[model samples]
Target: MKIPIQLNQENLQEVGSRMPIPDYNREADNTGIVHIGVGGFHRAHQAYYLHQLRQLGEALDWGICGIGLREADAKLQDIFNKQDHLYTLMVKHSDGKIEPEVIGSIVDFKMGTKDPEPVIAQMAHANTRMVSLTITEGGYNFNPTTGEFNFDNPDIQHELKHPQDPKTVYGFLTAALKRRREAGLPAFTILVCDNIEHNGDMMRKMLGTFAEAQDPDLAKWIAQEVSFPNSMVDRITPVTTQTDIETLAQKYGVKDSWPVTCEPFIQWVIEDKFSNGRPDFEKVGVQFVPDVGPYEKMKLRLLNAGHSVLGLLGALHGHPTINACIEDEVFKNYLRAFLDKEATPILGNIEGIDLTDYKDSLLERFANPNIKDSVSRICAESSAKLPKFLIATIHENLAIGGSIKFATLVIAAWCYYSDKEADQNGQAVEIIDAMSTDLHQAAEQTKTDPLAFIRQESIFGNLIRNERFTKLYSEVVHKMYKDPNIKKYMRDMISIE
Candidate 1:
């Protein structure tokens, strides 16, 4: 079985359709599992898992139908049509090995807003047993500080008015659940696969808030019937570039028009509660836990927290790649100290987890040179990320009177990164966020009041009101602001010698 040299649509299908010697599609019967925000991560992780289950005969009756929220429909529509809803997944490793796999989890695609009538009606179908989402942390439109629904968002307002014609993810879920309640249908599980602390609980809160706002009857129905399952999903699927396309065609010898590349390592920890039913994912590599809290917290506090700390710091210091950042003596040492000295104390001991081994493997993953993932790319939406990565750890650490000095360094790095005018070589860097302008404005006010700069009610919520964090953060900010060379300051502060 020789591999192809170019992976375009035609060559990919010709090869993909024949590989693994199994036809999972034949066993599938469109058991309704609507997936929202079908981006690269979903395609790489969750969809890949389901495709494997179908191949193993457990998910034979469960096929995925992808729905695009907001303006995501056009781009995904083009990709689905180009490749017949079949795409190539290249699993790349630090060892310079590449495994090209054909993923067949998605059978149909619809831009719900483009054709809202049929898509909304489809949710009412009896076979539709679940609704899974990877709408990102920001897509939920929940305030990061308070972790409550942001009803003030205009899009949310639109959805509230026309619940059936949902303009937001919460609106869609709430409206669909209402339909199920009216029909006396069992509520399907609402699975949230994002990098948030207690993803299930957070999602449930948003849905609960939305439901409460809509009507009391609908709210009570959702509370009793629906189960929001928490999950920990991990994979590094960088945004695809044209260079990736060229490499896929030249290196893999298959023509995959929209191929998704990711690291070989993947993890998914899920709660085993399903309202209607779920595939037996145990045969694959998924961990079914009694409570997903500990696992979720560990990932969020360590890997996710580490990513933001090094990511923004790396960006601020002009390191382009995450590997390069980890390789830098200053940044790498800062990260090692932060994770071990700061985060470990707060994370404490979780069952089956060794903090030292976890940090070692995480560092290795971050140092994979072949994975040219940029800090800027991963550092997008810091407003949503900080709560999960930094603030949550800060909260726990504060409870025990543990020092948040390292956490303060990470926060300072974020403020500086947001204020930088150019990249390492002085190339202009684009700040990507709805909150960027506001962050910039806040950064400008730092000279007058360091505490004011740190007090983004949107990012930290009222967590800054804590006298301890405010006191500690004020010290870090004043020092970083005065020194004007934070990289050197970090190097000196974490000096081993």
Candidate 2:
């Protein structure tokens, strides 16, 4: 099929597609939100919602100005620049239906490598009342053990010393807020859209730690002025591929260089706290609440943690994508047992949320054949992800004397996957973690002594000292190693009959 028109601000009125395009005036829209980490999730979710409001003529000022920090971001900067900051979002439903929309919320963007000065200037600009972030779970740079900002990190140390010539995000935020202070400008509300549990509070601590290292006075000013509202954002956006772009052009009649494909479902639950007033996101189905704690915990324990379980086990079983994992009975049954027997016991109640229904919804989402969500993507950054997603459930289960059968399996499955060059079906399993070198080395050491992996003090932190956990983990790892094939062993171990 021939492409109808190139997706751009100039071609929206002329483009023919099954879905909608922004009819709002782009030139008249002013930038109100400077989003750090312009990636797939931010574009598909928050940016999509903002575009909704923009189309309604309600959010003319909340147009997004995206900022890309890393060197690789230059690719995206060029992609957006060529398209006039308009990209297509193709929503894939579970039933195999596709809905494509052209989003025009991102009015401007700055590449940090090209000119860091403009990013700071726009961030400090009076129109920029809020700074939102989707920089992934690990980008916050907190010490895993200490639960504080890792000021001792070499990059952070450099930023602390030279605040003006900043590199780390903390430094940029610190410098921008300082400028706001001197100029008597009201500090922007810091909205954290990451997956960290108690995200707002954790962000406050991290940013506050950065500020304190710079100047005690500035630290105090930030603590008093800025509002870091905790938020729960849920969407399964797979990494974009060139194939996705080609398919969009072929099937949807739109030619997009870099388009984001996401599931039809999307949800954002935010705490009602903003230093500077926020946009009318509630109009677009954003849940504004008095407290985001319950919602945060629910999503973390069930969705994020559940993803980790499926991710590690799926990889070990030689499944490539999440839907592939869902297709297997052994994995799906084990996941349900983990949720019902282990995770749900420790979970506290969230107001108006039906836990059972939520769990069912997760199963449906995970089983969505259209999403094409990769197990490898979910398995990436295991060092950061496992601690956030799985460790909490382990600690809680162990403390309460709940059966850790599933937690043990979760860790054991990861160990089993890491200890091999390829998964059970001879599919290559890449260990992708920032700490992969050290973690893989430790995993290799565990071949001799099962305790080597758990002995990483920064990650385990005295958890190995627990007699029950240690015994169970050792037994699980030893059993996993003794078995010649992982699939047969997992069948018996998880009781997958």
Using lDDT as the measure, the top candidate is 2
Name the regions of candidate 1 deviating beyond 4 angstroms: 1-13, 17-22, 26-29, 423-426, 466-468
TM agreement with the true structure for every prediction: 0.93, 0.97
lDDT of 2 by residue, 249-333 (tens): 7887888899999998899999999999899999999999998888887888899988988888888877889988888887787
What digit string (tens of lDDT, one per residue) describes model 1 on residues 1-497? 33543322345445755443226653235656888888889999999998888887677767888888767567877878776677777777888877777787787777777657555655666878988998888787777766667889987788777776677777777777777788988988889998887888888888888888877789988888888889999888877767767676676555666778788879999998788888788788999998988888888888888888887777777788788998888888888888887788876678888889989998988888767787888788887788778887887778888767777877876776666545434566778876898888887777787877668887876766899888777777778766656687687668743
lDDT of 2 at 339: 86
Candidate 2 has a TM-score of 0.97
> What are the clashing pairs of model 2?
none
Per model, state how many residue pairs clash.
13, 0
Q: Which ten residues in a row have the lowest lDDT in candidate 2?
A: 484-493
Model 1's alpha-carbon lDDT is: 0.78
